[model samples]
Every structure is written in structure tokens, then in C-alpha cells.
Target: MKQTQFKLICTLMAAVFTVSQAAAQTKEKQIFLSPPLIRSIYTADPSAHVFNGKIYIYPSHDIDTAVTDNGSGDHFAMRDYHILSLDHINGPVTDHGVALDIKNIPWAGRQLWAPDCAYKNGVYYLYFPVKDKQDVFRIGVATSKDPAGPFKAEPQPIEGSFSIDPAVYTDSDGQSYMYFGGIWGGQLQQWATGKYQPNGSKTDLQNDDAPALSCKVVRLSSDMKQFEGPVKDVIILDESGRPLLGKDHDRRFFEGPWMHKFKDKYYFTYSTGDTHYLAYATSDKPFGPFRYKGIFLKPVQGWTTHHSIVEFKGKWYLFYHDTEISGKTHLRNVKVTPLYHRSDGSIALIDPFKSK
Candidate 1:
């Protein structure tokens, strides 16, 4: 071929390659309705709160590791927490580096899982779950004056706290309650007898016909660092007032508890771990004998489902995470989308994979 012809062919090929690269980059940056709220690093288990008119997210910082999957969550070897903020819905998110690290926590052993943040009387409390030296999961608290923090963890875990997923919800009457617990990898089953049994079953009660395991809730003290009373069972009942059985995986509470109030009714939302559904129940009080409503979020492209619901600027939003970025269970990313409530006082279900 002539030299001029060859040069023209090479130029066309370069242009095609450039276009293809740009397209792939664009696709990589986005999933589920929009790009990840924080893309600089992998994050999951978003605990979002609106503080001082801005949305603050406390998420588990996922690090890539070669830990073999042990079904009890040995593969999710997270070690730190990062705080993310956004001025508005669908706006740019600001990642505020490392808010808390395991190295700085004296009582923490490993695997810093889901976390939540609470602000009271000009102080911000960050609640997280990590394994203690004995390999038992316990909840801990850290404090920071700012919503985004270099928080200082207390020298010890909260007394009588165990398992994973610590979500603190403050009710309208100025009372704060923490809803926490998880099965399987979270080790909720091991603590069923009110004591940590090393040989406890990794999953729920083997009898499917029996009442399923329930999460725990306790009123927070004025200091916001400790519990005010004995932990109570957060029972989720079906429409017929029957306790959901262990076999009811689709509606049973597994992990990731978040409470929000809409129009004077309390909404208790949580993840059905093995089923991967973001289900919710409602009650008239904060510590609820909540009635199971239905699932609001269908499963995404990941194994675990965790989320937070918050209202910002008169609109509600759901902040959740999935493995869309890395396509691996332990490495996930956080994303946000608007949430809506139907006029009949039910939450509209969200299917993340549905087309725009």
C-alpha cells in the first residue's frame, strides 16, 4: 500500500481506539442510576445522616484482600471508616479521608463493619462494630466535634453490645435508640443465649418453624456513649401479628437496621442478609413491635444489602452500596437515589436494575 494510504489507516484506527477508551471509562464510572457517591475508594454499609443541612455518610472502607470466604464473613476484612458529604442530592460528594481507623482503636481486633453517626448537643458520636480481642464482635463509639471527623474511639467497647451493624436513631421526642445485630458472618446467632458461645451456630436457629432471630435495641443515655437500659428485642411481626419464622428469609431482619419517621409513623428498615432484600416494618413507637410492611429495595448486583434513609432539603433519599464497581462481595461502592413514599403511607419499592 502507498505510504499516504497507510498513514490514513493508522489515523482512523487511533481515533477508534480513543473513542472506545472514553466509552469504557464512562461506563466504569457509573452504575445503578448514577456514578458512585464516592469513587476514590471502595465503600459499603452507608450510614447517612443529615447534619447542619448537609448529608453526611459514614461508610465502611472496603480494602481488597485475599482472605478466603468462610461464609461467616471472614472475607470482609474492613479496617477503617471514611466520612462522605454532599451538599445536595445528585450533587458532588466530598470524601473526608479517614475518619476513624482500627489502629487507633485499642479494643478493636479487626473487621470494622457497618457504622452510624449521631449528633447531639454539638457533639457527633460515631458508632461502629468491630471484633474484640477474643474475636467476638462488639460495638464501639468515637467522638468528633465535626461531622467529618478524625474521631477518637473510647478505650473500650460498649458494655453488653455484640454482633455487627450499629445504627443509632434519634426519635422526635429527643430520645436516641440504637438498633443492632446480624446473623451469619455478623455472629448474631452466637450471642442468642445472652453470652458469646464460640461454638454457636453461624446462622439462625435451625428450626425454620420457630421465631426467627431478632435484632436488639436499647435507649441511649444522655451521654450518647452508653445504653440507658437493658437491650430489648426489636420484634418484627407479620401482618397477622405472628413473629416471622426463621424460614421467612425475605422479611426477617438479618442486618443493617435504620429507623426514620415519616408523617408521625416510625419506619424500621433493614436488610434480609441471605435474601438480599431491603425490607421495612412500621410501628407507632421507636422501640417497636413493628409490623412487617414489605420490601422497598430489591437485590442489587451484590451479595449483601445495606442502606440508610434520610431526608434532605424536603426530599427523601436512599443511600446504599453494592459490588458494582469491583464485582466482588467484599469490595463495594456507595450510591444514592431519591426515595419516595406513596400517599397511602407505604414506601414505594425500588428496583435498582430498572431502566430509566
Candidate 2:
């Protein structure tokens, strides 16, 4: 055979080998157990829960990348929330559509951030945050009979809400607790007055023992709208039993407050910005004296890290977000992976991974 013919035959053989290998790999992987659980739209701050025997997620819908500068998408300009669900971990993700939009919110300005949901009696309540007409951050609650709702927001914001990121937990005994708030020392005093006024708490710039930012929790009245008791500060301690504070501090509560009950422990978790990581601390009670264990998820490729922990069937999982799909810093997609706990009940560090 001529040299040209020999070279063509060699090229054809190489192409055949490559095609066969690609087919084999595709057959070996399934999407059910992979990362980036949803793909149709960019989502962030995933709060997963099982309701009526099915898995549902409440996530903030990120603003479109087209309007962003050079499509960098470096700002959180979200104006709505989307609820998603799955029949099983391996099943298809159902887009329940927009549950709530900021435009319909009479008093909201923009920037809808991390939200959560809880089922009480027959009502499904969505707890979320948005900037008021004045740009002050406030938390609010909306209700719908269906888990995936065209939820109706109460005409006014939760009377005393002034911070962001709301997570609701209902105890086994029927008592419901609402956990919310983050950063800024001065807001605590405003929080105490049931309004956002500057006269409330004072920010201490130098105090390491009591950082300006702390997670606050209050008992929710049966209505899920009113505070049942005084708002109390939840003190988070570092690994050495010291207080975590300051922007540069490893244990500082930058934002995102989530609570999960496992066995007999209540886990209080949050994201420490500046060095984004999903860190947690456990306490015997819902409100803590939580002793910081350590970081479960390392810093993600994005600037913020927020998550929700849930147990479905018998396996535990962490649901978070990253910019992998959009390639823009602010427009993120939700992802989840199996989470494991050590013998002592402390969680194991989870490294991020992608699914096929």
C-alpha cells in the first residue's frame, strides 16, 4: 500500500477507538447521584426539605447573565424565588415555576436572597428576605396551601424583621422556631425593638468575644408571623471554645444561618465569607452555646457559600451552589452530594464534585 493510504487507515482506527471509549463511559454514569441537581436556570442558596413524602427545594433565582457587565454577573440582583421538587433522588427535577416574585411584593425593592420553607398544620410557609423600599433588609413569610405555590405574601413584612436568611424548624413536640439574621452589630438593638431603627444595638468594632454578627433565633407564634418570645442571640464558639468574630476571623458568621436536627443534636451552620466555607457547630439544644466543629465544605469557586442539610430515606446530603454552569460569579446553580458524619457525630469535610 502507498504511504498516504496507510496514514488514512491509522487515522480511522484511532477515531473508532475514541468513539468506543466515549460510549462506554456514558453507559457507566447516571445523573441521579450527581452534582448541580438542576440545570434549566441559575439558582442559589438551596434549602431542601421533604414534604408529604417528596423532596422539595426552595432556592433564590439568580438574575440573568445577559444584563451583567461583560457577563461577569458579579452582583446578587435576584428578584424572585423558584421551588423545585423530585419524586426521588434519582428522578427528574420538576420546575414548579415561580412561587414568589419581588414585583408583586408591595414593599420590596430588589435583591431576594436565601430562603427556606416549613410545613405547619396544612399550611406551607415560605420564609424569605428582600430589601424594603428604603433598601433595608427584612425577612418575611408567605403562605400557600400547596408546597409549590403562587404564594401570597402578607401585605406587610414580618413586623420586626431586619436581617436576612430565614430558616424554620419545627420541633418534634409541635413548637416552631424561626432562625434568622446576620452581620452588623447595630442591628441587634433594632431587632430588639421589633423594627429597623438605628437606636437599637450598638456595633462594637473591637470586641472579639462578642462579634457584631451573630445568628438570632426567636419562637414563632402559631401564626408563623409574630414573635412568640424575646429574640435571643446564639453564641457560636470556635473549635477551641473561643468566640468567632471579625471579617478576617475563621469562625465569623458572615451570612447564611441554617439549622438541622439529627438524632439528638441540633446543628447550627453558617457560611464564613472573606474565606467562604460551609461551617457548622452542634449543640444539645436548638439555640446554642454551639461548639464549632470545623468546616464541612471548603471554599467554593464563588464568593458566597450557603447550604441546607437534609436526610431523605436514610442518607444525609448537603445542598449548595457554585458558578460552574454559568461561568459567572453571581449566577450560580444548585448542587448536592452525600454527606457523612464521623463516629462522634461531627461531619466529615466534603469536597466539591461534578456529575456526569
Candidate 3:
């Protein structure tokens, strides 16, 4: 065969190989688990929960990118809360209309990101991070008696550090714990929060009595607030250990810390590698001695993954955004999938070959 034919064959081979690998990764149990793939009703940060026999989704309203909402598409800055109900967790979705419009709340003009909902006592706490350039990115508390309602935002935000992405997890003991900030934190956490000192309890951050859970919970106190114990230093997301994100005393991986307690161990998931793909750490207690688990996911043919984990009702989902070819970083949509966990206890995202 001539050189040109050989080159053509080689080119064809490369394209085929690339396509095959891509198809296989997202197909088989290979790459990692990501979300919906086709985002019809969500954007940026996604907070999904099963409430009243349905999965209600709250997505980020902060349209930081250049894309225009145009009153349509994922670019729209969500001012009001849009509620969607799905009978099955892998949603065939229907928007139940705006459950909570900004006008329904006392504070009516802030952007929302990563809104979290938790049912406690007799009230539903719709915990969300508000986005305002002039305002400190903070978590807001909204409440309603009914799951679907004109949910009202509390006059006061979850006051502590400047924050965002409020993820509330009620422990097996009925302890309601909130995890967020960082990717939710915006610029505040970027340069400082990663430095670490062992023995610091998380409860040292605030004096609020909202529920008693520590804001940091770097070490779990019966109450989640800052620690009650004498820890070495205050809570910080340690990134000096992980080499993938970046290397500097300044660069750290403490963005989103969501944890789940297993038989005898606690699995803590946080974002570090580029504020994309998920990474995790495990500890005997909610506190330190956290062992690093390398990249739970990597950038795939689809979107960049963030704020992800296994959900209740036994299905797993990865929440993230994919940049459109039309525009790079601005337009993001949420995707979900049925996920599987590894026997070794590590999170294995589904590869293209196994996505089916």
C-alpha cells in the first residue's frame, strides 16, 4: 500500500479507536457515574431529594457564564424555585410550577445555587446558597409545612462563614448535618481553607443555635456546629496531600464535604481536582485521620462533574455540568444516572461502554 493509503488507514484507525474507547467508557462500568446526560430542567449545582414519594430538584440560579438565558435554555438565572416531581428517581420529569418564587420570601432578589431540602420535626427546610456579588455567598433557610408550597426563605441566612451549596444529611442517629461551601464558597475558600492542622473540631466556627450541628464538623460533635473538643486547629480542607489538583500551600480541596457512615467507617466526598470530578476521603469518625481516595471521576465526553454522591432509595447519581460546543464554560446542564459501588468501597464511575 502507498504511504497516503497507510496514512488514511492510520487516521481511520485512530478515529475508530477514539470512538470505541469513548463508547465503551460511558457504556461499561468503566469511566465513572455522572448524571442525567440530557438536562431538561436543571443547571449548575443540583440538589436532588425524594420527598413525598417524588424526587424534587433544586438547581443553581447563578448564571456566571457568558451565555444568555433568553428566557429559555439552561442559561436562565433562576430567581424563583422550580419544583419537578418524578415518580421514579431516574426521572421522567414534570415541573410542578414554581414552588417558591422570590416574591414569596422576605429577601427576594438573590440568586440561588445548590438548594438542599431536608424534612425535620414537622417543617421542611429548603437549604440553599444565595449568590450575590456584593453579598457574602451564604446558605439560606426556607421552610414550609407541605413539601410543595410557597416555601419561604428565612429572614436570616445560615450565618457563619461566607458560603454556598448547602447539602444536608441526616445521620442514622437522626442527627441533621449540613455540608457545603467552597465550590459553593467561591473565592474565599480558594486560597486559604485548604491548609490543615489535625485535631481541630469543626464546631468552632459559629455560635448559632439553629440546630446545634457544627458548621465545620471537621470532627463530628454530637451537634454539628464547630467542635466541642480541643482539636489541634480549626477545620480546613487539606489539599497538600493530593497532587492532582495543583501544588501550593494555597491550593486546597475543601469545596464540598458530604459524608455517609458505613458499618464502621465514614465516607467523605469532596471536590478538588479542578472543582470538577469528585474525590473522597474516609475516616473512622466524622473528624480527621481522613485517608485520600484518588479521583472518583475524570472529565469525560460529557460534562465536568461536581457535587455528586449516592442518593437514597438505593440509586446513585452524579451532579454536574457539560459545556456546550457553542460556548465553552458558561452553559451547564445537570445529568443523572443509575450508579453502582465497588466491592473495595471505592466509587467507580460508569465507563462509556457500561453507561447502558
Alpha carbon deviation, residue 126, candidate 1 (Å): 0.4
What digit string (tens of lDDT, one per residue) describes model 2 on residues 40-154? 8899999999998888999989877444332111257888888999988768899999999998888898778889998888999998888788767788788999999989888
For residues 227-292, could you state the per-residue lDDT of candidate 3 as single tens digits? 234322113334453222223112234355566665566776655423244666666666554666
Residue-wise lDDT of candidate 1 within 1-356, one digit each (tens)? 34564455445434533453344344444446645777689999998998988899999999989986445677789988889998888788899999999999998888999999999999999999999988999999999999999899999999889998988988878899999998867888888788887766424435588888999999999999999999989999998999998889889998999999999999999998767799999999988899999999987766778999998888899999877678766788999988999998899989776464
Worst 10 residues of 3 by lDDT: 204-213
Order of candidates by TM-score, top first?
1, 2, 3
lDDT of 3 at 133: 43
Q: State each candidate's clash count.
A: 1, 2, 38
**TM-score (C-alpha, index-matched) for candidate 1:** 0.90
Model 2: pairs clashing at backbone N, Cα or C within 3 Å: 189-200, 189-201
Considering every candidate listed, which one attains the maximal lDDT?
Answer: 1
> 229 in model 1: Cα distance from truth in Å?
0.8
Ranking by lDDT: 1, 2, 3
Model 1 CA lDDT for position 80: 89
Deviation of model 1 at 247, angstroms = 0.5
Of the candidates numbered 1 and 2, which has the greater lDDT value?
1
TM-score of candidate 3 on Cα atoms, chains taken together: 0.65
231: Cα error in model 3, Å: 12
- Of the two candidates 2 and 3, the one with more favorable TM-score, higher being better, is 2
Judged by TM-score, which candidate is best? 1
